[model samples]
Target: MNNIEKIIEIKDLKMTYGDKEVLKGINLDIYKGNIIGYIGSNGAGKSTTIKILLGLVKGYSGSVSIFGKDIENENNDYKQKIGYVPEIAKVYESLTAKEYLTFVGQIYGLSYEKCDDKARKLMRVLGIDYAYDSRLSSFSKGMKQKVVIISALLHNPDILFLDEPLSGLDANSLLLIKEILYKLKQEGKTIFYSSHIMEVVEKLSDRIILLNEGEIVADGNFEEIKDSSFDGSLEEIFNQLTGFKKHNDLSSEFVSILKEV
Candidate 1:
């Protein structure tokens, strides 16, 4: 609504790598307390746009503003209100879960004692407190993902950026996480969720933005997107919008090749 605060603004955004263009003139506005599902296939500029928004990537041409402040300006204070869980969990394998979480919390301006206490409590809540003292190297993919999620929320950020956040989570954890995101939105926190799982996106997102090639092909709610294309589910709409209708053909060809002598 017009009364709600605008948390993120991007205008004429564009990025390139050498001769290849990644993002081509993206313009979008996101409001607080919204769960925005940003979906795209491989090389569709999804990650690139997220990176630029997070200040992790450079050489992008556009005007990006977060929390009403221009990110291009000299001030980096806006980042303090942002939390990000990258597509890959990059942890210090040598460090224990407690140690790593404590370190991350401290980076967010938390005191050592406070960070340690908070990390322990969070790990307990996530049912991973038993492995608190264990090195990250000993943790499974799902465990590591939980740790990353905790670290991102350690500061209780106003905005959360998640890429493939539920990648290796179990069914129970996945359901819990979805509930947690809903609670966070109720608290007026903005969530920018990027994933290839159309079902989850369809269920969780207040709005969906689908990108293709280097541009956005669709942006709306599930019903609106469906109405824009043929009547179908989100996955079918995605396939239609992306111009991909060859799943059976591709699978048959793949199996035929495997059958070859």
Candidate 2:
């Protein structure tokens, strides 16, 4: 993977909202066809970086380039090759599943005929075969998630950004999605995956980039991450790097509190 070309690059990225600085001098590169697990706790600047990458948040001081083209010069034309599934399902609740997907496809400059065909096939595979005409407000969390996933994939983008994409999926859906992502990788698609599910990241990620306090804390594969001779899962490595201490005494402390009551 080291020999692979970088599809996205960020240099000296910094963003400040109001008085609070969110991203502080960040630098990173995303290679083509790499499944990068972007791990971070709440307020660790993960979302901020993604927003900047997708051209949502603006006025940040730094350089961001995609396909070696400066974003300032390229904007939407450059963004067309990217697909994003946000952490929240924020689609129009009044629209039916089919209608919502049509809207998304249109936003990506896809035709209604193309969207209908793609949406039906994707929904069938994602286990929403029967909900195409149903209102989005009547759908469950998992159902809505399926729709969001289909929307992002409707355009067959080169770069896919998934932020907690498996938020409301069931076991079957989770397995199916993992398989689908694996297939996408085989097809040479780059994926930026963000989630708190350490187990999933450990299993699927070709490389893990851990973010802490608006900076890159650790960036490498599992072996490279455990190069310090620590033998454990990504969760253990994460805890060690993030200054997490053993909570062996916390259980007893809580028990004592319960006893006091």
Lowest summed lDDT window (length 10), candidate 1? 223-232
Give the least accurate 10-residue stretch of model 2, judged by summed lDDT. 240-249
Tens digits of per-residue lDDT, candidate 1, 71-137, equal 9893778888889999987999999999999999999899999999999999999999999999999
User: Candidate 1: which stretches are off by over 4 Å?
Assistant: none
Off by over 4 Å in 2: 1-3, 246-260
| Model 2, position 69: C-alpha lDDT score | 90
Against the unseen true structure, what C-alpha lDDT does each candidate score?
0.94, 0.89
Residue 245 of model 1: what lDDT?
A: 95
